[model samples]
Target: MRQDTEGLLVRLESDKDGILSIDRYGFIQGINPVMAAMLGYGASELEDKPVRLLLPDMDEDLQGDEWRAFFDSRIERHHDHLLEFVSAEGSLIRLDVQMFTGDGLQGGMTLLCRDMTLHLGAQESVFRQREQLSAIYTHATDAILLVDRRGYIENSNPVASELLGLSHRRDGPFFIDDVLRIKNHHDAWVYPFSQALIQERPVVVTDDIQLVLPGRSAIPVSVTASPVRDRSNRITGCVIVLRTTSESRRVSTRLSWHESHDPLTQLANRRQIENEIFRAIDHAHIDDTTHIFLYIDLHNFSVINETCGHGAGDELLRQLGRMLQEEMVNQDVVARIGNDEFAILLWDRQPEAVMDEAERILQRITAFSIPWRNRRLKVGASIGVELINADSTSEIDVLLSAGAACAAAKAAGRNKINYPSPERDSPSRASLSQWTVRISEALDENRFVVYCQPIVPVKAQRDTQHYEVLVRMVDPAGNIISPGKFIPVAETSGLIDDIDRWVFERLFTTLEALPSEVRTGYSFSVNLSGGTISDEKFRDYVVNRFAGSSLEPGLIQFEITETAAVSHFESALAFINALKAYGCAFSLDDFGSGQSSFNYLKQLPVDYLKIDGSFVRRMEVGEVEYSMVSTINHLAHIMGLATIAECVENQSQMALLEEIGVDYVQGFLISTPVPLNTLF
Candidate 1:
């Protein structure tokens, strides 16, 4: 372990931030390679040095009541105190320091320091952008065309130049009417600039205001013309804003069907779909025909983008689009509305036919595979269906209903078809919007921490205490925040993998700081998020950690939830095999929670099966639950694997687990989670 520590220290010597320890008397007792480098001193040269060597404002001997007062007021679990230091090059360096008081009252503090140069730089950049917005807004993508009172073009921004097809024209005077072919609601040709200037008010055009191009077809744009005022409030010119509008954003406007298809999938975009819906609604009202709108979303497709690459994700989407086209009739319309999301409009209103098509599409997606770099990747999809008839509301209402149904399906678990009910609450969307900011802020501030929970053997085993590393967040006020409060938020936002990485890095740093007995004696079971399990970069990081660490690989164990493993079986197996090369053990955590747990367990080479805490906590109350625990325990042992019971909160529960041949147990009854410092 000492050998590994030395190697890791050497590897970490180039860290951008500094790390040091300060004694009770404000003496710098020890510093890591990073702090030494930051201060331009050898690691040994900084040992047992007075803190005044770094902080000149401090007295040579900062002891007595002064030191006592500092401890009483300054000691905290988490501190965001800032300090300025003269760097090795004699330049002022501002440092953001997070300090945690060490084990004892008189003990020193461990400081994790980060340089604030880059953060300050980003702030300055934002400030500069805000200050210069007026000068830069003209170059923005929004088209701005300036026309004089005579309806002749006076000036135009670059965006307008592209939109008006004027990029190829030389410098010359142009008339607004000659440039744009504007048709109004009365189906009469009108000049927006002339109208706005004559009326002294804005003249908006949402109808067909198509920009005529040289030797090409016209593209529709929403035109807004307002009189540009001078100092006396006199009309100096008419400013025309030309924005390209999709059929969905248009006000009762329709476009040619072939004009709005997504180029990649040759399927309709949102614009075309909107047009189709409008036509269908009119037809339904007149002919009494009915329809079913299906909103489909691909599950875990983001995993492909995160692991294999976005190119692979796009390819998978294309494949699914082709399959949908093959399964649908000519009357049915499909659109690639958003990323990994599609909408299909079924012409028939029969509930049975609509469901049959939906199921067929689901099956095709489930069985479909994409060729990603020489490997075949799997896919899953969820669907929501909304039936529409002659009595159905507007196109927008039906679209929203279809969306709600799709959301309900995903909430129930992906790869299933669901219909939205009037009473079912949809909180997943709200949770995502509320937690994204908080989770992002937590990550940026490095507010996450690792806590170790003791996992003791049900029977006599090693005296060394094994632990499962759990994650916790340290709020700004220095209070401990539970994982249950933020974990689901992180997972929903695809940020759980980031949190998992933070946990591992923190746990690894703590482990490297411990003595060989305390470090190597304990076996660690770190939780792996499903997102991380599917990420190639995560796999690489884990492999690199093992390559650099001095401890035996067997000492490090990984615990992946059963549901995650089964859902992404191929990816999980590949990840397990990669880490197994380094001798790291694996545990299938939360086992017996899934419908196909045993079936997938037969395929996994896991060393342990951790029974779900729900079963262990409730087994004593229900015979069925108790039988489940016994059956899982026996089956695991039969498969040459040990069992660990979670949430064992009493001696009776522990005794029951031992009687059932469970190998280990973890809960408040045995030990609660403690800081890594205390564990060591």
Candidate 2:
């Protein structure tokens, strides 16, 4: 029996694992060959070594006296402890050690050790993967939240905290119903979490979510929720994400402005005018109420912008906006729709009432003067009032017709308020439809005609001069329709380019037919619309029209309005430079009409500055008008540019313009816009 026990003890010691025996003093009494090898020592070296020698210095005290005290008090108690040890070669190893007291023949404590390095490495790898996934979850821009089946938030990321304005912490599970605050239709009961949850399917809810902040205003968030599932494919929880769309709301407000207000003035534009007219018509249909559309155009605003800087012009506009706002009824919709035009929508009003309001507005604007630099600039306004029957069918048509009437009033004189006449009533819907059809037919049949208006030199050193070719359309009555009536319609219909091509082709052919004397020393300017300057194809067609003609490239000046030239400056510059290379001279028409006139002039290569008609017609006894004309003439001369004054109505204005050094003049006084053959 003794021999068998000895053999069993020897077998356990040589078992190729780990074993140790300690004395009451916590010193190592015996160690197996495997245990010594694991600690990088021989059995003889480790046999009586203190166990403290195998551990790090910081842990020596922990396993030394304190462990001895613990063993003394609890001898029979078994305990498992993790320990770190430094081997003889200074490598760190982790081990799990079990200590228990034995009371057989040995009568001492036995220690069992397991090399746990591989098990610990596997656990560390799992920890690292969990950390990586958590990092991805925290940094994602999309707001993510985890909620249990009851809609209580379990875990949420930083994005959710930012979007919801809430401090999220891991606590007892929460329900989704409490967070969203959804209630029943009766406003008496709360909805259940199950009602809103669907596993793995996204649900969008665009309700006003109120978020309370720390002593700040409540923010609105748009929330979207989707359900999450477990490995068993059962509905476990949900994920909710939210975004703050305040800026989007602001953009929507501006879109409403784009529909009803002017882009420049931020006031109700022409579209709003039409809307007000229709509203009035609807009210009249039901309640027998009347309304008025007052078209108010600044009379000398063009002169102010052209003579003074456009900054001054803009100041004048803003001043007029304030004045109209002050003078009109509180219910009125005042707007600055055009460059120098305004409108007012008056409800429950008569023509006389509108006229009276118009007079007050005009007086206020005229009386108002803004100090610009060293000068006080004043301007006037013209108004036209049109009373509409509450039951009118075509409200937009009537509003535009009233606008035309206002323009006619301005043409007649400034500071005058004209009421719409019977001629200014809305055209028959059938007539407009017929006109639209006829215009389309005319374009398709190529029935458009080109007429040339001579841009003659006022101080004529020669008899023959250049002419500007204008377009006209012949109607079924054989009467020519002016461009003012149909050009805007064509432009709106995307057919202006075709019309421009036709005009260019016809002008080229007419120049080919003219005798050499008529064609020689005579240049013809053609007006290019804004639609044409940005159009590469239309520009190419213009170039091609002059390709095989008898016209000199320098003589055929392509006239573009200042507003159009400045709109797409880069494209205009490139197109103009290309045309210049082909010997075509360019002119900036309505030179002082736009805001960035001087800047545009410096960038554009043009031969003439066609002074806007506004400045010329206003060049009367006023010192302001005289000073403006003189300044323009001096500037043109300094820039080596010849000037043409438009709307030269009488010899008195003409004589003053000539004295002011205007090189050429064109209007009814010099000559009416005549036909091409009449010049011969």
Candidate 3:
């Protein structure tokens, strides 16, 4: 027995687990080399030392009987537990410990400990990796799903639920067959997920594949299926990804169509027609062939457009385009070139045939009518024919000849055909017409800004400020343009009302943002075009804006030229009376520039008159100019109205205006126009 006991002790000393024995008084009676080395000490140094040196948590005041009770308690309560110890080098050691007390060799206690720090650290690292993978799955852009070995859905991301139309509240052990159904080009089932699982490789389908839901339309997608493998190289499941391609395809097709076709009429547009003309010119030069180009302008079209709405005009144009297309041959091209205008090109036709075709188009347009509301609207066309022969110049010359011929036809009579020579048909006004696009673009891009020049009272006035609000446009190159360059074109193209609205909206909105005292103290003089003053809608818009503004009624004063007021006399009077009833003011600008300025003054209810700059600038030199200014000022005072002299440049002009008793003076002598932002 003694020999057996000695062999057991030798075996225990060589074991990997650390072992120690302590007496009831808490002294280390015996310790194996393993335990001593773990604590960074030798067996001789620790064997006789108190156990409390290693276990700092143990109380040092315990006596022999107290130590006996403590050992007993540790054996019962802390068996097979985790505890911490301080090494001799002041490092931490975490261990899984077991205690034995009754059969201990020293009649105290025995400890067996295994280090657990490395094992627990490895577990925490694996947990973090799983969390990162879960985040990727949940937030991926493409729809993704994970399947199990038995073909059942183990998990899915949020995109998968949305793409497949699955409800999160549903209870299920969902199978891959029920959740993901794919169809090939022939409407036959395609099991990419099952194939990926069986072959242990990725399967991708980019075309002619659709995902079918139970009650919704099938979605076109590019699908990819990849097998999920374990560490042991065995297939466990598959990942399915779906990316949509429907919207991209639709956008591409729409863009391709709009490149050559008009959005309103679905016919060839001007760009397409120009390309065809170039091709025709090239063919004519090579083979000496002839092509006939016809420019068609519809008459009385604006009558329907303005009387009935623009929708009616658009419908009429569409109907006319269809009729014109019916008259063309296979190689012929028909296109809408402008508002209420269409062009047709007939290839390889003689001069007589072209004339007959133009006549037929005239009769066809005159006969066609469209029904709107309770009435039928009919229109006539004036056709201009240009024969393109081998001697025909460039495409631009051909278009110019056609346009000039059309102008001659309109000048003669309605529903007529004319082929006037380009040189005699009145030079092309295209240069002036191009300003329409520039002005429209400036308004759309918000490139216009307000500028103001002070209107100083010649004599000292109290609590009153006045300025003339001017408009300037900023081009794409950052250059400022004066109104004289574009205003004539805007008036001719019926765009002056739009310009007026733009200026009024910007000025009124800015004024509303200022303090009440500032807004009420100043009066702004805004210019009004003849078209704007005649428009009932513009008048209503002004009234509504004034009703909503916080400014005083007298804050905005309208300035109109004598010619504008005289041209639209009745409408101007009504417009003035409507706003004048609302406590607004009006000024007659360029008073003596018109032929009958004084004759119309008796009928006009104005508060101020501005002498024309032409007379004001030469007043210091010419007696006639000076006499005109004095007479106008005397007449304005007699009618109980104030007079403002414009173009007052030098002290001589200012002194002349003061001698004439003018109420206000505005010119370069006072100040040039500055941006509104700076003054405010």
Candidate 4:
């Protein structure tokens, strides 16, 4: 009988199902090998032990009573119960148990226990995974939500709660439709979500969706939704992620403004105007619309700058900008393209309408008044309107043509609005281009001539006097162009340095050509531009050119304008002192024109002070002018320097200058600015 029972225990141990038996008192009467092994114990050891010892506390009390009660009934044949057990090593295990009551046996109960450990382990693993996933979802930066098929929130992360500004009370589950009120908040994005759910496909929504927060601050968000699916490929719900794009949109708008607008006046800059014109032309191409560009320039702005000051000019410009902004329509693009010029682009407007607008703008600008330092200053603008045809191709050409029209308007008169005319469309100044070509050719052919004007001593105070060297251009037509005309042109074209060098070389040649007697008691003063004085190489070249001449350096006085001297003071001081050490005297020309005072006068190392022509021109009749001349002469005398009064056009002016104590006088009254041969 023992051998047979042992064999039965082996068979039970090999079986997948578990078996056990207990008495009515909830004690283990007997247990199969499988049950014992599953509990990590021997069958003999488990026999007669209380079943409550092998079960977890959570199920021991209730399950034991239920098993006893069912066994007592006797009619309840087989009852199933889900039981939780604790192994001998203290690990929790789950079991599905079935109990049977024996017919003849007293206080006997049969329990068929299946392990169910692997299934419970797998369920626990899934629970833990869900917990980890929930943690990650709550901390995600992008707001995430799980919406059911009916557009109601089934589950959501903390990020979603914060993004939607929802309360976190644990009363009940929250619904997306109720909390977000997305239908009322962002109607534009609702369609995409509905479509995604119905079609069971992913969809993106990127409109100007607005979200009204608790404080009524509308936050714009861009939402994207995708359908969630289960293992069977059936749609469970949809997952939506919201991104707050309000800040990004603001940044994008600011970037666009900075790119197309000027920082100073907050108006369209040159690039913006160009883009507007191109866009206007493009629109006109697509439709039968007309476009016009108006180029407006302030007349006599330079005169205002000279007479009042740059501060007044700047205030006027700022006032004009404000006026333009106020008067023009929002659709028009007005821009400040030049120093004192503005451009306006009119789209889809008639030529007459644009002309009327231009006239109105001109009138407004003319009527605008500016408050200067202590007075009210008035100014006017000139407008040039040019129409663009559908066939126009070149933007630069249109702008240039408009500029030419503006120039014509200004030349005609002040406060004039001019349209492009065929007659004026042809070049206005033949002389300008002709002079440019002639000057270029003359520079290349060495046709520039030098003339000298004498700065003679007023009395017999000194034996030697200096002659001011001037340049003249002799064209192929044998006409001499004065320095007043060609010199300005040369300076504008950046050819003044070349012409200056040529003059120096000619002056040296003329000096060499002078007779010994004339050269003995004579000194020549050559005028130099501020640009040439700033050139170190030119300074060195001048020094080298006159190094070995028998004529002493004192006989060649270098005359520079007071403005030029002040601009390049440091270098000019060094150069002049070095040349003075070599016996070359220095003279300050146009002395009173700039802001030179007695302080700068003492600092400058010079032998003569040339009174400005303006002061000298009025010296004969004006007591104030005569007093200015006398004061300069007195100052020069104190500094041990001689004085030259310039622009003495008549005998009276000459006599007045002499009486003012001027050491030298230079004007056409004594003798006109004749050629060097006349002096000889």
Clash count for candidate 4 is 1
* Candidate 1 accuracy as TM-score: 0.48
Q: How many clashing pairs per prediction, in order?
A: 0, 5, 0, 1
lDDT of 2 at 523: 74
Best by TM-score: 1
Question: Measured by TM-score, how close is model 4 to the native structure?
Answer: 0.41
Off by over 4 Å in 1: 1-319, 323-381, 384-431, 597-599
- TM-score for each of the candidates: 0.48, 0.44, 0.41, 0.41
What is the per-residue lDDT of model 2 for residues 1-680, given as tens digits with 9 covering 90 to 100?
01222333544644655777777556788888778888888888877767667765334556434655544433233244665667888777767765555444254455666788788889879977985787577555555677877666777665564444343222334455545453223433333235446325666645545444455555455556766778987788776765555766334433544566554454667767766677767777888776777777665565566567678887767666766777765356787766667777776775556667667767887787765653567877777776767546566555555565675686677687777655555454214334555667888877788777666666767554767778889886778889887776565333666777677777777777777766777777888777677788877776676665556656667888886677556557777888887788777788666665575577687778888888888879678767877787788888898888888899899889878878888887866666765655
User: Poorest 10 consecutive residues of model 3 by lDDT?
Assistant: 1-10
- Residue by residue across 507-615, what tens digits does model 4's lDDT show? 7887787777777887788887767877889888887776757666577778888976765565577778767867888899988877655766788899899999999
lDDT to native, each model: 0.74, 0.67, 0.77, 0.71
Query: How many residue pairs of model 3 clash at the backbone?
Result: 0
Model 2: how far residue 52 lies from native, Å? 99
Q: What is the C-alpha RMSD of each candidate to the true structure, in Å?
A: 26.9, 28.9, 34.5, 35.1
Q: How accurate is candidate 1 locally (lDDT)?
A: 0.74
Of the pair 1 and 4, which is ahead by lDDT? 1
The residue-level lDDT of candidate 2 at 415 comes to: 80
Q: What lDDT is obtained when candidate 4 is compared to the true structure?
A: 0.71
